[model samples]
Target: MSDRWQEMAVFVRVAESGSLSRAAREMELSQPSISRIINSLETRLGITLLLRTTRSVSLTDAGTVYLDRARNLLAEMEEAEQAARGVDSLHGVIRLAMPVVYGTRAVIPALATFMGRNPDLRVEIIITDARQNLIVDGVDVAIRLGVGQLDDSTFGARKLAVVERMVVAAPEYLLKHGTPTTPGELASHDCIIQQGAFGRESWRFVRNKTVTSVRVSARLWTNSGAGVTAAALAGLGIALATPLMAEDELRSGRLVRLLEPYQLPPAEVWAVFPAGPKPSAKVRAIVDHLAMSLGEKT
Candidate 1:
């Protein structure tokens, strides 16, 4: 039999690149050699692992199952090699996904320090509010806000931060309209509401451990957190926003918190990744760095 490790590596590369030619180019091997390795592996295992077409190649059912195990095995092998070389020397690309707001303000800043420490590693960060399917997107890890509702049976998660929601309004707006002391009084005020990935028209508040729900009518509605913050700062109306997003304004007194007695639900930020016997050194390093940075901020 041929080298099982070499065959497994080729299989993984093909699975990741989605085309034999691309995988061959990535692995620095000829197309025929890549094809021969995969075919030999499939023949030896008595399984057709991939479905190929002119346009694309996809994993068969067995291929999907085998792919997951193969990935874990490769990861373990890489870790073992790294261990032999000393864990500190290991390096590779780490693909990460994060919400746009947090990615810009928080994650990016923290990454500078991480990069300084790990010069051999490269990070590719995708910033968007939409949750990505990690395996399908080929993301190594993702920073997700709120409770991770994604189905992650084969993944692990680490809580990075907890963001408390606050009712905020521009100083000028509050000066003109007056601040509401109670949740009920918000009915009389113009509220800039958000309708996005989290939810629409559902605002929750808590007082003395008793929670209440409110459906505040929006004078201006937006799906972007940055947009909502901008509107509120321009004296449009009151906005319910997370402290992380409004920290600068709140500190500068550009925005003032209102209805302090009633509490909004705190969203938890988590670092999520595929479950494996041993996580890549780069993944663990980034996750740990984020958790530490966020924890300190919190």
Candidate 2:
């Protein structure tokens, strides 16, 4: 800061010591040099810092406020320095954003374990489905789904997991309309659209190296994965979703996975960050933990 930090350090020492001679001795500088730094700092700030007398020095009101704030800033800077120097490096707040259902069901639990290992670290979590501007939001990192979503993203990413998805329908709906044996048969059935989860109108399946897309009628449309599971549970229509989104229902037999012979392409999850400076040690460490933890569990 053009030596402003040095000036503040000198001012803090002089204010605490209450004498130019003592401050100079503590810093190994001449008393006249210490006096000049304090004078320049007060002049540049346009505020009187110390009430100087022949034998004693005391703070003015403005000086008292500045001292409190300066101490806090200096302490934070020291902590940042320690982390950068790799002395207990995971020592700062990391703002992370992710899709709601996936984050709650998958990421947050794993994040809790990561936090346990690095107790000095703090995290602020943002749950959302919208694509966010990392710089604007001050997001240090983000967890995102789908390869297509990341194609135009300015952030860089590393793959975390490939989530398998399948078509599902409530037992009541399947009972009403006979179950389809092939992907082509979905053309006649109404499907619930998790608006952005899999994309619009068309659903694709891959079988024995052959890929096929089928356009189905949308019976309901929602922007959330949880909503898709809700509608499917209500016997509304068939839906495309990962097992995590409807884990309870799937396990309880309320929803049944369909199209056993074919498979929907897996959704790719990534740890994405802004396009500048390499990710810090804490960020990289958490990503590594997530890759291993989330991969094995979900």
Candidate 3:
């Protein structure tokens, strides 16, 4: 490889890995080699690309800008080579992050279909409820749930779907505690809360432009969306969830939707990616596939 090309690639890997050692291991180069390449690149550019401490590596302001452009340039180059070779199918690995429950319930099926169509493409999924730092985690994409969860312009975002928020309870629980006729009655009932970034500690409802906000207390606080659904199914408490979480149960009459005609503001599902540069073809394709699948699910 040309010296400039190799140096920029190394620097991008180091930044994505968040450490010299990790980048070195991935590239099958010695740590010293990785460091030397970064140093040489910085020296040639007349600007520091990284601020390295004993334990961590962070991008300088200029480094961030360069990483963005360099990554885009390299990606485009690879894609160009693929196009020239008449490789029309997707290839390469995509590291995707998603919420634990949401991934299982909604994303997996979509991903399965997408992967099936592209035999050469590989996907690595990291499922969790905690917020992911996409660039730092080396994640190509992350599926974010709820409105306002992705508030910054530091990343590219696509609205996959507007998920309807439903308040539901097991028939047993409702029968025992009496079904809530109004959103106000929820205060007297035990609610199931999904904790973490997408948690709803309070529920909001709207009817004919009238808005109602109700703060709820839950004896059961679980971080997973599936946990909330399981709790509601076990007759533990009422839960605020999406149709994606309770479709089967709701259809089976195991869980009953509460407070009719009070339309809650629809929450959103987003496919988020690192800031700067348009996402690669693989990332864009998978995100679009997920959006289509989620639309069908909803």
Give the winner by TM-score.
Answer: 3
Q: How well does candidate 1 match the true structure in TM-score terms?
A: 0.81
Global lDDT scores for all candidate models: 0.80, 0.80, 0.83
lDDT of 3 by residue, 161-244 (tens): 877888899999988999888888888899998876457667888998989988887788987888888999999998887887
Off by over 4 Å in 2: 2-89, 147-149, 275-277
Candidate 1 local lDDT, 132-189, one digit each (tens) = 8675566778887763364565687888888778899999998899888888777788
A best-first ranking of the candidates according to their lDDT comes to 3, 1, 2
Give every collision pair in model 2. Answer: none
RMSD of 1: 3.4
**Residue 263 in model 2: lDDT:** 85
Instruction: List the candidates' TM-scores in order.
Output: 0.81, 0.70, 0.86
For candidate 2, write residues 1-298 as lDDT tens digits: 9578878877766675577776687577998998899899999999999888877577899987886666456556655776777765467567788998999989998887788877888898989877766644557678988735665355558889889888999999999987988888998998998655465788888999999989988978987788889899999999988878887898999999999889887888888865323455667787888999988864
Ten contiguous residues with the weakest lDDT in model 2: 273-282
Top of the candidates by lDDT? 3
Per-structure clash totals for the candidates:
0, 0, 0
RMSD of each: 3.4, 13.0, 2.7
